[model samples]
Target: MPFPLYLLAMAVFAMGTSEFMLAGLLPDIASGLDITVGTAGMLTPAFAIGMIVGAPLVAALARNWPSRSSLLGFILVFSAAHAVGAMTTSFPVLFATRVVAALANAGFLAVALTTAATLVSPDKKGRALAVLLSGTTVATIAGVPGGSVLGTLLGWRATFWAVAALCLPAALGILKGIPAGRVKEEATGGPALRTELAQLTRPRLLLVMLLGALVNAATFGSFTFLAPVVTDTAGLGELWISVALVLFGAGSFVGVTVAGRLSDQRPALVLAVGGPLLLIGWPALAILADKPVALLCLVFVQGALSFALGSTLITRVLYEAAEAPTMAGSYATAALNVGAAVGPLIAATTLSTTVGDLGPLWASGLLVAVALLIALPLRAVIAAGRSTEVLP
Candidate 1:
């Protein structure tokens, strides 16, 4: 990969860390602000909601700005938000900081991926996207663990401070490493926006967005409550739960890498495989939760299969929506955040009155099965579209 790709990846790593670290730090943050852990948990959902709102808003506003400038500005905003969040004594203030930080994060990711795709040839788009997105997977493997450890030892605020420190170096790296002309310029003004919005109205693109949302809902619904389920139903110790999360992170690392490679070869097949795997894994996870050894294995498998869909789906959407790639990419990010927001809500509601923790898993499984059925007809639409040829 190019040096600019590495710089983009670094920014993504910090953003990923910032987004997920809240979960690990919730207890410390709650105690510090004299709020309930449930209230602290609201931070995660708040961030996702902000991302859903920010992706399109930022994309539309920054459409004419230089990509390099836009990226640097968003990083500055993100860094400042984290710094403020770390210093704040009030829960509400901290929550607002998180929301602002999430806005920056969502905009950065959408811009970064769109920028990455433009930097490479069409055939190599998947690889470029993979290189950029690997930072998020790496964050799962390294950033979350390190942040959690830091939070445990030095308090959650310290973790945010450390994360804030990273932003400066990441910004500097981007400034120095990425060339001015790295991002391709689109035709600007009213015509560009109109063209992009029209592409979004296409049935094929809309279906892909819906499929992306459904797939995410399926995976995240169960994943959002994984720790509690492990403790309550699996009868595992907290330490074991942490170990399982690490295992899941390991699987994500491998999965993202494999997905990157396979997407370049067969994007559609990757999606086809992912939907069924999600459907199977959820129910299987419910069954295996009682067996500690089996549960660990399932965690790895579930992580791998669940995340494997990402790169493939992204590349396919970009390909199919070539007329307005940036807008499509932004919409895709919005869809992802929408799923993130909805998934946990569904899981929490189902688990509220259930007999066991398995309720979430079963609910997630059924949701994925429905998504899979919906995707079948859409897959045919994509195939049929590809089969047609236009006359010169």
Candidate 2:
């Protein structure tokens, strides 16, 4: 692709790093701020809440702005929030900054999704989005771990500083790459803000977004408690936690890469094969939780299948919301964030029951089966779209 897409991915790497790296930095942050780790942990939900709200709210507010300006403004705000967060001694201040940074991240992602899809030809949208999302997968594999290691060696503030510094080049890229004066709405012939917002209520779009969210629910549910599943359920040591995470991330990268290439060409086939595998993979994972080798290996499979389904749903969201290009990205972003925020909360509830650590896996299975049931009536619709491509 385009050179600008790479820059967008770079910016997303910084955003994704800040989003996830907190998982590692929470203990250090709590210690430094003289707060409990539980207090520090609240930052994760704060960020998620911001993303859930900001993705739609900010995109709607800036719906009429030029793409380059909106994008640059978001990056600048994100960078500033990190810088302020790095210098603040107060936990509340840090918490506030995390929310601000997440808002900027959410806005940037919304605009960037449209920008990425707009930059390429119609058929290549999947590849473009794949390239953009790769940053997050790469962040999971490299940035999150590296941030943790960096914080351990230095301080939590250093990780914030590093993320701030990382955004400088991305800001520069935004300026250099996204051409000036391309009003986002005008480019796509997007309607008024009210009309754009109305797209969120469309039945087809709503169902697609719901399916995407459920897929992500399964993904985040499984991923959030992976450490417990590996260490407690599978009878592994702490060291195996990192190994399992890395394997999962590696599989996600492979999954997204493959889906990017194949989704538009054969979405029907992707849904046909990938969906059932995903549906069954969870129960198998839960059943084999006690078997170390089997459980660890299944983590990789789950990652691949889960992401492939999630990514396709995003592509479909854009298609279904074709009339509302500006908010289509918001719909997609908000859908995923909805899953991100709700999935873990739902999964956490299972821990209190007799199910214990195995609860998340079973919870994931129930969510996946429901998503596929929703998919059942929609298969004909999916197949009909690709006649010239796959359906024909």
Candidate 3:
């Protein structure tokens, strides 16, 4: 764990905060821009679209550049975008800024993950990714809620200014901490774009991407509707929403910590533990929605299980496609966002068409079950391969 890793974590925290803070400030933004909340809510997915589009594009463009320089440039652009966003009043300008910020975020994360991975040994990649993703869970815990309060007290624009301020220290640290010429110029062009794309089509890489997506779909699908389920179904009222969310965040933090420690030696085993937790947690969540305490407890467990997949997914992809590390990581990021997109759509559709308030829970549980079915066989293969080597 070099100091640069922690600095990268700080950089990730700043970007992660901007990514999620919009969710909490959508109401204020809607009123300020004179748009409906639903229209304002579209900013979240717009950002995701930018992320999906940006990662590979940035990797191609910056293929020759050093990771430290690329990281600094992206965060600088990200900070400036937020600064302009703080001054903008029109909805279109704000939305454009969101997309711009998201593009910067995507590029930064793709580089950061690969850079962090390369800095450590093969076995330590799990911990490296966990260090980086911990920032995201921390944002869920602190940044989103804090930004919401800031927007309520000051204005939505104030939150943007605050986010801009957060980026400054990270940019400075990247400049000072990450040594120049640290990352090797990537293996001097062995493959063309067509070949690289063809390589990425391998079944193992695809499975890893699908695993990333499914795990996230399960986590976020159910979470998107948690407020309604807690308040309406459990009769817990609005205040409990905040408490439940905090508990969820706390559980997420714990999960990442524990998973980081174990995933290096037992990556597949971590997934084995995590997948079943969702299987048990979700049905319990649906059944116990009538009991506030039980619902809250299950939410915590589900949150932990959901996020515990983060390191395992990334580590698995890294090993599966070691030859194309940057693209592999970018693909994983895109895949996880794909799941993020899918989860919400499934939950929203289930609520509108079929299931009622409990729809998301049931839908998410089924998704986790499918992901587990995928994981079980994959885990068996991984274990078999390892056993063959060990016995030989």
Candidate 4:
């Protein structure tokens, strides 16, 4: 609805591209850097670790800065870190660069969420947040595939270079579009932070965070090792694996778009429906892996249903902690990153010690079940919130 929101979306697109392109380019990066694929995979975790640590820390540090300036500075830092990553030949140096880049990227997202909330009226907050977050889905559909194709045609380093270049324009867009002032009129008094922290003490809000973590664990735990499972375990060709990824990305785009629209109407219903579908899709996917067509269909369904829950879940967190919207949003993002970091490591261990690729599916199913159980208790809370006179 706002021009500044569009600029923020572009920033999100660039960040998502940089973050997710690694999965497709992992092999290329490993070969280029004379490292194993296993080692290359660590970069994903590194980025998540950065996000987990950076979101709250940076949000706190930038609490007093003008939102526009903070966002622009973070983008510059993001661009610079990627530039350094593209140029580095040493493994340690590249790792450090990734950490810095991811930290900036996480900080950028936290600021962007806060900025988006400020850009819209209270009643339209859900839709506004959904529109801003939809950029991540768009990146999955367009940016990641485009960057992966470029990496295949050119080099992995070239992909990072492109991401770095995109960030420059994003930074400039934010500078020109967003007003240069503190986004929130409410002062970030010490008591405000304390109140925000206290919001987490509520069972409803805490349940939302735990559900967020479980949902992420269910999807990402299996997704992190998708390529290996497809190629090595399922006997699919490399090209097929790429096609599956693209299919998954397509599903993600559709899911998020639909979820965004539905969130404006009935967020709780979307989550109640979508969460179980995600759990169901995983086992179905594992069962159909040997059949190319079936597996592809399952991949699409899995991707769609898995990500479809995002907006609803995040909205749930915000609703539960309405008194501290920005801090709640930041913590929500932090919880997601923490899950992202933990999921893959747990999956990796399961795969190594277990009999089949089914390990991830089973584990994911269990995680999803736990998340669903958590959501059940919150039904009354959400229903009560909806019945209230609150507009947003």
Distance from true location, Cα of 60 in model 1, Å? 0.9
Worst 10 residues of 1 by lDDT: 383-392
When sorted by lDDT, best at the front, the candidate numbers are 2, 3, 1, 4
Alpha-carbon runs more than 4 Å astray in model 4: 185-191, 232-234, 353-355, 382-392
Per-prediction TM-score, please? Answer: 0.93, 0.95, 0.93, 0.92
lDDT of each: 0.77, 0.86, 0.79, 0.77
Q: Could you say which candidate leads in TM-score?
A: 2
lDDT of 3 by residue, 269-386 (tens): 7777777877888888998999988998888888888888755776666666566755656776777778877888888888875558898998888988888788776675432222
Per-residue error at 149 for model 2, in Å?
1.1
Per-residue CA lDDT of model 2 for 1-392, tens digit only, reads 99999999999999988988887788899999999999999999999999999999999888888899999999999999999999999999999998999899999999999888889887877788889988888888888778888998999999999999999999999899898976677635658777877877777778889998999988998788888888888889977877787788778888889988877777777788999999899999999989999987898898889888888888877777777878888888999999988888888899999989989988998899999998898786653342234321
User: For model 2, what is the C-alpha lDDT against the true structure?
Assistant: 0.86
User: lDDT score of model 3?
Assistant: 0.79
Error of 3 at 32 (Å): 0.6
| lDDT of candidate 3 at residue 54, scale 0 to 100 | 86
Q: What are the per-model numbers of colliding residue pairs?
A: 0, 1, 0, 0
Pairs with backbone N, CA or C atoms under 3 Å apart (clashes), candidate 1: none
